[model samples]
Target: MVAPASAPRDLDRYQAGLAQLRSHYEVRTAWTSGQERGYLAAPDSARTAALHEAIRDADIRAIICVRGGYGCLRLLPHLDWTLARTHPTLLVGYSDVTALHLAFYARAEWTGLSGPVVTEWGDIDAETTEPFRALAEGETPTLGSNALSPLCSGTATGPLLGGNLSVLTRLVGTPYAPDWEGALLVLEDVAEAPYRIDRMFAHLQHAGVLDAVSGVILGTFRPGEPPTDRPTLSLDTVISDYFEDRPYPVATGLPYGHLLPRCSLPIGVPAALNVEEDTSHLQVLQSIVAE
Candidate 1:
């Protein structure tokens, strides 16, 4: 497993999940960091090389990142994508891995998994793991936002794009920034306070990013709550402002992101969003695999 970010706090926790993943697949881990504690995977080093090689391996159909703390952003510039484009693979992970997802989308138009990583695989249930398995098995996987309640009611269709709100916002104006036009942006994150969420949303709105999207799918916003302080703006209020007077469909409670049993989602694929009649649904319109 590549340490594309902060090394796992406890090696054993990650090892347990690695065992679980191997149980399901012919896993070949790239221990690029030599089982080191805390990362020193500098650019163009073994750490970055391992992931690039995996993406380009003709026989390795998928690449699952082991953990996501904070680091993939630094590895983006150093990546070599020729082999990856020639030999496509499913790259999976969320949080800090958002950098890699959008980078791949912009550089190669390669759709990848914006889902749970290895260490996060503890207590994997059908509700969570099934979507990812169906995706890997190429069964025209579609994840439902059954947990989501409508925030703004409407129906829309566009390419599904976005992950970890903070990571995505960081890419704004960068070469790797995702094209927001006609995209159904799905966003989620963990630990950030509601105001910080508000700030990121504001950045997008001001940058004309929000206006460029057809709709928004709100995934599990970590704590899924507003601050306890009375003066604090509820996450609902902060988000609602972005959609106010706009017709974009907005909804929440998607079982993705930092939530348990997180469902897998494909980046840069066409998907339909329905948020009418008090219900919210997302139907991925195509298999993400390239023909």
Candidate 2:
């Protein structure tokens, strides 16, 4: 979990949750600078590399960021994707970690998750626990709620990919941006206005990011606002307008993003998308790690 450079008020809770999480699987914690001023500042490269090595050598089945903040992108250029590819594992995080998720998908063609972090442990609600447990236990064909918007009705199958929209947008021209072709693109964001969302989508469309995808899955847009005066456009409208007459399926609200009881989706694994009934289902076709 990306602890702000400052000590957290709930450090004990965080530690306790970490302990519980470790009961199910091996857990390790690493950080750039414990006493640093900002969470986004670049991590010490030597130390960061060492931590990556430790994780790689350990043959860890999963890697979860302790938290999300600004500096994860700083480690992107230095990351050895070769090691990650050889030692395939479930790399998981959200928020700022979105940058890393994009890097993994683009560089390694490996599936990762844009789900809860260490901090989310203490806040775990019943709604989230089942899916989280299922993911950890390698359950397949997970089905989720249909509360999200439905732009079109259809089913498409491809690898799952995406995370925080803002972070995804940040890597637009970079080598880390995902190859959207034949991929089920899922996205979510927090604290942005509808206009900002529209602009980001516009950017993706202009960059040819959206056109290549097999389908689109939109997660929660938390803390976002529609303009008060004008009847601002909804997310569904933006999606439909963007993918007008596109062949791919478009479905929203897969219970991901900054929401309780989120699905621990594998980013690079082939999965089926069924939107005809306004439901999205993901089935892990094979193990993400070598035995």
Candidate 3:
């Protein structure tokens, strides 16, 4: 484990998560940070060095972040893409880690998971971890959600890309921005007001990201506390204005992101998106880990 973003606020909970990992697999920590440092888990130089060490270590097959808060974007310029590409280490985490996922993907074509961080593992139940376990074991599991609701009707097959929406929108016009062409964009966010969400989606549209993606899978966008002081449109209303009549497939209520029992999705893997009148699901076409 490495803390590339924020350090765990509760060390005991972090230890519990480590115990859980040790129960299943041999676990190691390259470095850690304490809350004394303030917002960043560690200095950018130290975080980048530790990450590079993990990347070049042949024994480390995967590099999982301890938690996600902020600071990952600061490490982008210092990342060793040549080493990362050659080593092919899988990265795991979500939220602020989305910056790293997309940057590694854009730079080295690295395929990682937008799943639980170490701190989150302590609280995640079996069902929540099963999909991640299956993927780590090289099993391609079909993620079908009965709760999926289609906003637009169609089917699309493409490499699955994307994570936290706010994190992704920040990459626009940067060298680390993803190749949006023919991608199945998966998105989620937490604690943002509906207007902010609307602005980000508009930013995507303005950047031509919306036009390039083959499909869109909307995940949990848990709203922040509603404003009682003014009139505002509902979250559903704001979102529907953009996707309800898209040319490609679009669906919401994917069981991923911020919430528990979230499915672990592989970035840069071929996947199929099916959105029909009464059915919706995503099927992984192949294992993310090469044999």
Candidate 4:
């Protein structure tokens, strides 16, 4: 899928991972161009067209994005929502690929995977990929964080939604933006400074999207040290400023997101979040795969 910028540097690695995947499922690949590596601005029309054709193919059971750098937004206007709605399998990826997840959920309520891309296959430890593999085999995936710190402890449940904060916010006013209402929102981002995170949260709040969320599951915020000048606000303060007063639970410590050892989440599926006893857990309440 490589919807965003491609990772030609990992072509051999991607092929090896795909070959491994093929041993497990009826794997398929789409024709792409050198431009898809994002050497140029956006992917060629042939690459985008190939993606459209792949989705409409009834035989395709899932689409795994190759990598995420930057390019999905440009391709959004070019996708065919009609053919996309007919897509019966899971859409998988994270980071910039969140654009496609929100679009798929918004346009047709199709399930999406907020997990590893093909380039990351080498890092797929069993602890991380096992639940995803189980889900791929038509079993409902189970997720639990080893630790969850409570901001507002309580219990809530709703369809799971959200992805990389920067990417999700990019779609806010667009037609592809998801109506995050009645959702147990899960959010994670990488490298963005605390103030930038605060601004994005303010944007979501102003857009009236947070009003729809029943609870929030926070994942890794900064995969590395945030580049900030002195007197920088704490990310915790920013999160609490937005979430502490909410009636629903707001918790952190999800294993999914930019860090290693992650699990794939079924976007838009019902989820249960409990923050009672100062401990927390989130569970998908229904099956994502069709029987």
Top TM-score prediction, candidate number: 3
Scored by CA lDDT, what does every candidate get?
0.79, 0.69, 0.89, 0.77
Candidate 1, residue 20: the lDDT equals 86
Top-lDDT structure, candidate number: 3
lDDT tens string, model 2, 1-291?
333112233567668668767876777655434445444323346435643765476555677766676666667777788887776666767777777777877887666666677767877876776666665566564555446455667778887878888878889998888778888888888888777888999998898888888888887776477668878877657766776566777777777787676766666777777766635454566544444
Q: Model 3: residues >4 Å from true position, as ranges?
A: 33-36
* Candidate 1 deviant stretches above 4 angstroms: 32-44, 223-230
Clashing pairs in 2: 1-66, 1-67, 2-66, 2-67, 40-70, 40-71, 111-268, 112-267, 128-261
lDDT agreement of model 4 with the native:
0.77
1-291 per-residue lDDT for model 3 (tens digits): 898988888888988898888888888896654432578888888899889989988999889899999989989999999988898888999999999999998999888888899998889998888889898777777775686798998999999999999999999899998899999999999999898899999999999999999999999999876688978889999889999989999999988889998888998889999999888888898787856
lDDT of 1 by residue, 5-66 (tens): 76676668888888888888888877634545455433336668888778766788778887
- Candidate order by lDDT, decreasing, is 3, 1, 4, 2
lDDT of 4 by residue, 1-291 (tens): 434545546678777667666666775666443554445224558557767777877877778877777767777788788887766568788888888888888887787878788777765778777878776666654466457778888888888989999999999999998877778888999988888999999999999888878899888888345555557778888888999888888888787788887777788778889886546788777777755
